[model samples]
Target: MGHDHAHGAGGNRRRLGVALAIIAVVLVAEVVGAAVSGSLALLADAGHVASDIVGLVVALVASTIALRPATDRHTFGFQRVEVLGALVNGAILVVVAVGVAIEGVRRLLAPEETHVAGLPLLVVAAGGLLANVAALLVLRGGDRQSLNLRGAYLEAMGDLLGSAAAVIAGVVILTTGFAPADAIASLVVAALILPRAAALIRDVVRVLTESAPRDTDVEQIRAHLLDTPGVVAVHDVHVWAITSSAPVFTAHVECDPEVFEEGRTGPLLDELGECLQGHFDVTHSTFQLEPAGHVDRGESSHR
Candidate 1:
């Protein structure tokens, strides 16, 4: 297929390291501000920043682990660590968002007194906004096709929005002495976190469960294989992702006996491999060339 795939995550790991540092600094600042001002919105924003810190840390570790070389005992060489990290990040975000939502609702009911020093809150939130923007830009140039990097970027974007919300809520409370505004802002931050967390979790589950690539149609693949000359049937076809960008496939292709007799299996195998790689972005595939009714005879079927 002539596609040159970039295999390592070294550059991405460096970027993630930088982003993690920025998030750690901002998270601490937000926590202190939340405590001093007793601002629900600021506290919620701090929680989001904490999530980003965790997400970035996971991304950095996964990226580093992903660069390890393959060994006989671990043939894939820890690449799947990226997917696992993404899953863990997703789960944590959901839990944290739920906690924020509950706190926000409770504050809305009772209206906690917010001694929001508006100018300081604004300054801190603005600084957080700037930091998150910087982190996002740093991660933007990395291999976002990887789920790990994508998760980091998404978390940073969410933190940026949360910071903006905190700034607006701070100004509102300062001007009107309205305490509910802080709670409302916290609710908004929680809403922003939920959908992205759910989506990330779904994607991670798909990969872990060995579901087919979202864009590849199994029926279409079967038809394409059947279209090849000397092929009689296709069975036990399966396609799945090993990571966000890496897909693995295996199938049993039944062909005429004469094709095997004539030592034509090599050319046929090459043609099938090229077809899969070019059409469906499947570079790793295993095909069992067999005579018709191979499955009926108790040949193993992965499907």
Candidate 2:
């Protein structure tokens, strides 16, 4: 398990490096294109790429931090730090989107003249889009389960859309020297960014606040464990993420007072852990084995 964990971290770190390089290249290209064409769409893409750079840097740092040993000061270690970093990335993404939206609106209000025709715009815009797509493909696997990578991946995804919007706008400007199309396209890119930023913020907020996973119901978990073999009742249940990939659960399990004292509680706790792992993917568990009727049932754990 330890070796596998080390390998995963190493792999993620390597991928993060690659992604960051790609974003750096894209940012420079997009900013130059924005300057040349005076297109808000190009500038908005630069902003998205900026977020990607920050997100990837955060991810790399978090990945390195997570590999550190669990010290007494941090009992659960730095796993959740990754989640916190991701939360910050999410918030930053939303802020970037707002800024981009403002730029788009400004562009809409005062359209800028651009010699938008031909090769320079298309070449840079296509390069940015291709870079974003490559980054997305690089980080694709981990995005589903890892919030840190997801934030980065989402940034890349957002960049892809934003870049494509810029490309379309550039093409339109090239065909007909109408500068308003660039601003309109930037508005469309900002709209795309809005929902993604909101959703990432919500998910990361839930994790940082220790909210239960949406798919796992605390009541249902308690009820299921109560029906397990040799279990008198269950209470004081707590379930939350240690990171995007790791969830921890702690609960007080009421077993028969006599049977639990000696080693009887071990197997029961094992079973409960197994059940939790199977059903909820909770990887760490702490059970406070208690006697029956010890605590009132209604006062279990926090809901």
Candidate 3:
């Protein structure tokens, strides 16, 4: 499991690196464009792109750290670093969204003070949209499988929407001379960012709190374990993750006394392991095969 996780992290790291490069290029262009055009929409998109760069950097570093081998002191190695990176990305997204929204509302209140050059904004926004598209494609494959990658992908998606909003605002200003369109577009970008940020943070919090992976059904897992031959009951069944893909499960399985005394323990363990891996996609599992009547001193206190 560790080997497979490290391998996947390697691929994710490479993807993050490529996406980071793409976003970095667009970020510079957008920043300059925002300054030249004095367009709030362009500035908002530029700010989102900047956040994407930061997210990708965090994800990239986390993936690299996750490649490290487990040691005695850190048995899980650095897999949780990916979750931390995702949390940071989520916080950054919220900050950028709120900041952009506040400034956008301020600008909306005084449209006459907004002197955005529509032509420059349009050209830059169009370019930014294309770059965002490229970055999204680079991140698309791994987003569902890794929370860290998903955070980066979500940032890119936000950047894409922001660029699109900027483009629309530019067009409205160019054709109708509506200066407030830029502020409206910035608000739209903020609106797009908030939901995605909320979702990422929610997922990160679940992992930090050691909650089971969302796709996993704990009751079903317990039932499955109980259905194993010779297994009478399963208790203290715990499921959680170090990251999105690295789920871990542990349980105390009560079984018939003959199952342990008659040399059947090995096969039972094999069957349990295979069941978890095959049905639940849980590669790391630990089972304590206890005799049916045996008891641990403090077992009643456990769940």
Candidate 4:
């Protein structure tokens, strides 16, 4: 809670600007290269670059909104904006991969005119790889804090990998005069993209569904609280991720009436908060204090 989010937002914005510029330049280069060379690999790499461009633009927009001050309507502010952008980005990558697969399948079914020039595609792929690698480094930490950043990084990395695959495929096509190599590389890129898209979808679902933080155990948290002094029992415990990285929890704590009648719950709550923060790494929490026996013996975790 004490961390200054402004620092992170500023960093993200700076990185986003750099990433967008890199993608734009490489994307333009790809279009020219693909048009001139008429190479399937170049076209595929260009398609991957197009995805990177969108992802970077998304990152830029998300970063700008992420820095906005919280409003009553949006108590969590625009942090979730980054997550939305990430989800969109990941989904777009899936679309791109599928599009590429369709093209590859079409080519496999009915072969078309393709100018396989190893040197031309190689030159374009090398430049693309260099730019995308730099973009990847710029977006690394952004992914750690923001979903938008993760999407952007993945797309950029996909461009890098796709370009590498295209280069190798181009070399083989040029050497052996076999056009299928290009389709093979495109298929491989498509396969690679499916798992990454699936993972991003899973992460987004977990966060939005209020699923438990991956590392925390609800029973373990309940036991920790029940062990605290003056605690009669603990119930209605819940722990879940607000985002991939942030966690929030809520619970109802039963306390000894004798001690509560003495108004000693303040210190207890403070101690409990500290314990959870230190031991469980639960950052945001709310607990409804209950007098012993005020609630039923069994309780369920909710919201």
Candidate 5:
């Protein structure tokens, strides 16, 4: 009646750990550069990097917790902790972006009051860019398969763009003596962060709300089940995700009475399970097979 598929946390903890180390080094460098050069762009980038460190830490801890085996009290185990960790990472990004944007705008309005040392800012930003590039590569391999990894990847990407912007701002200030370029670069960093943060939060909300994965089509699955040879109808079909990689499904499958009478129900169930696993990528599934004449006393209410 049901099948269980094991989904591991993958190599995400190692990826997060490596990314954390790379970003921590960058954060310290950026903070010192921001102080010495008096560059708001560097300062904003430092703050963002600080948040990235926190996000990576949360993701690392969550990925570790997710490996716990299922118990009687928690059938799904702690896999959803990764989603909750991603939510925290997303929230941190939003806060950092808003704060950076506010400070950027104020600095833009008073460019004359800003004093930035171009050469040091440029040197430090270029180094930060390289570090971010390395971090991105480390996190890239698993980002698409895991929400927790994707959250960390997005933050690394934000750092990459922010560092590039700071580099450009430094060049402009060094060549044209335009101090407002630093503020503009900080604004650009904020712009790059917000959309990605929103997307991550949106996905986290979908998982938390028990919504079907974006790529799954419930009607298509119903049609597939109905098209099977012995299946007369399908009802009470439900599909949702425990995490990005873990999907759960359940349905009541009305079958031909002859299928049961002839002892063919086992083969029919096997076919249905294969269809779901092969076509829908739904590894965890439960089917309540019944003859056409079967009646569900009170359970039919929802169906």
Candidate 6:
């Protein structure tokens, strides 16, 4: 499992690097086109692409930090760094969207003579769309369960839609003298950004807060442990994720004294671990197997 996780992390890093490079290249073209065409929509899309560049950088750094080995000083190593990065990236998206929206609204109210070169705007936006599609394909195969990767994917996805909108706005501006089309497209891009950014922030916040894995049921876990042959009760049952895909569990189990006497506690513990792994997808677990009434004898250890 550890080896597989490491391999997956390496793949995610490579994908991020590729996507980042692609976005950086396209960003320059979009910026130049926006300046030359004086298209608000194109500029808004460029802003989003810029934010994606920042998001990718943060995701890459966090992915690297998350691979660090655990040490005494940091018991869980730097695994949570990815979650933090996701949160920061999400926040950046929201801020960028807001700024673009404000500018779009201003443009809509006070129409300006945008000397847009329609063909250039269309070609540039189409090129951006193609680049975004390539970046999306690179990130699509990454671990979707990872918040860090998901956040980056969300930004790329938003930019993809924004680029499409820019193409439409450019076409409309060229065919008809509709200057507000550019502002309208910028508004559309902002709309695409808001919800995805909010969701990414919520998910990362849940992880940073150490909430239980979304699929885990504490009551069900307790019941399963109680149904074990030697377990009489289950207490202090806690389940939380160390990373998006890594759930950790620790519990205290009251067991039949006869099982310990007969030297069967080891087998009982093995069964418990297997049950958790098979039924709950919880591979990392620590259980304190105590004979019935042992909790009363060691009050300090109960927790």
Model 4 scores a C-alpha lDDT of 0.78
- TM-score, one value per model: 0.89, 0.89, 0.96, 0.91, 0.94, 0.93
Show where candidate 1 strays beyond 4 Å: 1-8, 31-44, 141-144, 299-303
Tens digit per residue, CA lDDT, model 2, 1-303: 346556776777787888888889888887887788675456656766877688779888987887786789987667776777777778877877787778767877876533344456677888988988898888889777678778877778878887787778778777887777766776787788779878877888788888887666888889878888778877677888767677668888878777666777778878888888787777678888878878755764443
Candidate 1 vs candidate 4, lDDT winner: 1
**Runs of candidate 4 exceeding 4 Å displacement:** 296-303
Worst 10 residues of 6 by lDDT: 294-303
Model 1 per-residue lDDT tens digits across residues 163-239: 88777877886788776776787788889988988988888889999998777899988888888888899888888
lDDT of 6 by residue, 1-303 (tens): 566567777778888999999999889998898788675556667777888899899999998888877899998777788888888889988997898789778888888645556777889999999999999999995647688898889888878888888789879978996878878888888888899899888878778788887778888988888898878888777788878878899988888889889999788888999999999988889988887876555444534
- Write one digit per residue (lDDT tens) for candidate 4, span 110-227: 6665546777887888888798888888888778776667777778777877887877876787688777777777888888887887787777777777778666888888888889
RMSD of candidates 1 onward, in order: 2.8, 2.7, 1.3, 2.4, 2.3, 2.2
Off by over 4 Å in 2: 1-6, 31-44, 112-118, 261-263, 296-303
**Which regions in candidate 5 have their CA more than 4 angstroms from the true location?**
1-10, 293-297, 301-303
lDDT of 2 at 261: 62
Residue pairs with clashing backbones, model 6? none
Please give the RMSD of candidate 1 to the true structure: 2.8
Candidate 5 lDDT tens digits, 1-303: 112322347478888999999999999999998888776667767888898898899999998888787899988888888899899999988998898899889988887778888898899999999999999999987888788889999989988998999899999989998888988888888988999999999999999899889999999999999999989988887888989888899999999989989999889989999999999998889999988867787678645
CA lDDT, every model vs. true structure: 0.80, 0.76, 0.88, 0.78, 0.88, 0.83
lDDT of 1: 0.80
Q: Residue 283's C-alpha lDDT in candidate 1? A: 88
Return the clash pairs for model 2, or none: none
